[model samples]
Target: MTQALTLARPYARAAFALSREGGRTAAWSQALAFASRVAADPQAQALLGHPLLNPADAVGLLAPDGADEAFTRFLGLLADNRRLVLLPEITGQFEELRAEAERVVKAKVTAASELPSAELDAIKAALKKRFGREVEIETAVDASLIGGAVIDAGDVVIDGSLKGKLERLQSTLSQ
Candidate 1:
């Protein structure tokens, strides 16, 4: 995982720079995401590794017709280098750069049960206030949490779940 990230860093930075210069961060984000998804597909993965496939054909497999010339060129470069498998990591890094530029943060919240819309909104509002940036929340239900929620917001993790509390209590009692 670390190696893939290391390999992806330069490409991601280059793509981010291009997007920033062109004032098309959102567009590049979508294109990278789409390409990543395509590259992850089993059939597409096989095609990407096919010895007979040319770089142009590989780019066409991932990119839509009439894509921006810059994006096509980027895809072609990846294809030429046989780095199509790094698309997902590149997309992730690109999103991180985009979020930093836009003053936004992505957070994951896992709860024992589905949170009410109002509750979720309140959580998001609080996160935005705490982080001093727009927070985009992704929620998941984890029955193992037993109760409450655990929030993973960038470098900050708030383990508020019942399971987490129990574990902490156990450790304290042991000590």
Candidate 2:
């Protein structure tokens, strides 16, 4: 995993620089996401390293509409280099760069059960205030949490889940 990310960093950085300069960050984001999904598909995965597959065919498979000249060229380069498998990692790093540039942070919120919109909105508001940036919340329900929620915002983790509290208490008692 780490190796893949390391290999993908330069490609992601180059793509990000191009998109930033072109003022087409969102378009590039969509294109990368689409290409990543295509590359991740089972059929595409099988074809990635096939000796007989043409680079143009691979690029066409991943980007049917040819989003733009730069993106098409980028896809061709990846296809030529047999680096299609790295699309997901590249897309992720690109998104991180885009988010940082846009002053947006993605927060993963895990709760015991589905949270109401009002509660989610309140959490978003609080997180926005805390991070001083736009908060994009992605929520999931984990019954094992028992109660409360856990907010994972990059380096900051607020473990309010009952399971987390119990674990901390147990650790303290053990010490």
Candidate 3:
């Protein structure tokens, strides 16, 4: 997985750069996401590395209807290089780049129970302040958390759950 991500990074950056230059960042993002979904299907996965697969056919399979010429060419390049299997990783990195450029951060919060909208709003506000960017939050309920909540904003994770606190306390006493 790490090797695939390392290999996909350059291609992702190249795609991002081209999309930004062409002023088609959003379109490219949607197209890449579509391609990624297509490549993720089990049937498509089986054919990605098949010796008899044609590059054009690979691009045809991955490219969405009415895909722009440049985007299709990019898919063609990946197909020719036998790197089409990396589409999912490449799409992920591309979205990260797009999000960074747009100054948006995505966060996930898990709590022992469903969070109230007011609490979720507060968390979003705090994260926006911390990252100095607009924040989009997705929430979930995990009963194992016992109490409190966990906020995961990519590089930052704040684990304030009762379960987490008990584990930490146990570790400290053991040490």
Winner by lDDT: 3
Model 1 poorest 10 in a row by lDDT: 60-69
Indicate the TM-score of model 2.
Answer: 0.96
Of models 1 and 2, which has the larger lDDT?
A: 1
Find the candidate with the highest TM-score and give its number. Answer: 1
Candidate 1: residue 55 Cα off by (Å) = 0.2
Count of clashing pairs, candidate 3? 0
- Estimated TM-score for each candidate: 0.96, 0.96, 0.94
lDDT of each: 0.94, 0.93, 0.95
lDDT by residue (38-112, candidate 2, tens digit) is 888988799887989999888888874748888888989998888889999999999999999999999999999
| Candidate 3: stretches off by over 4 Å | none
lDDT of 3 by residue, 121-157 (tens): 9999999999999999999999999999999999999
lDDT of 1 by residue, 1-175 (tens): 9999999999999999998888888889999999999999999899899989999989988996556889999999999999999999999999999999999989999999999999999999999999999999999999999999999999999999999999999999999
lDDT of 3: 0.95
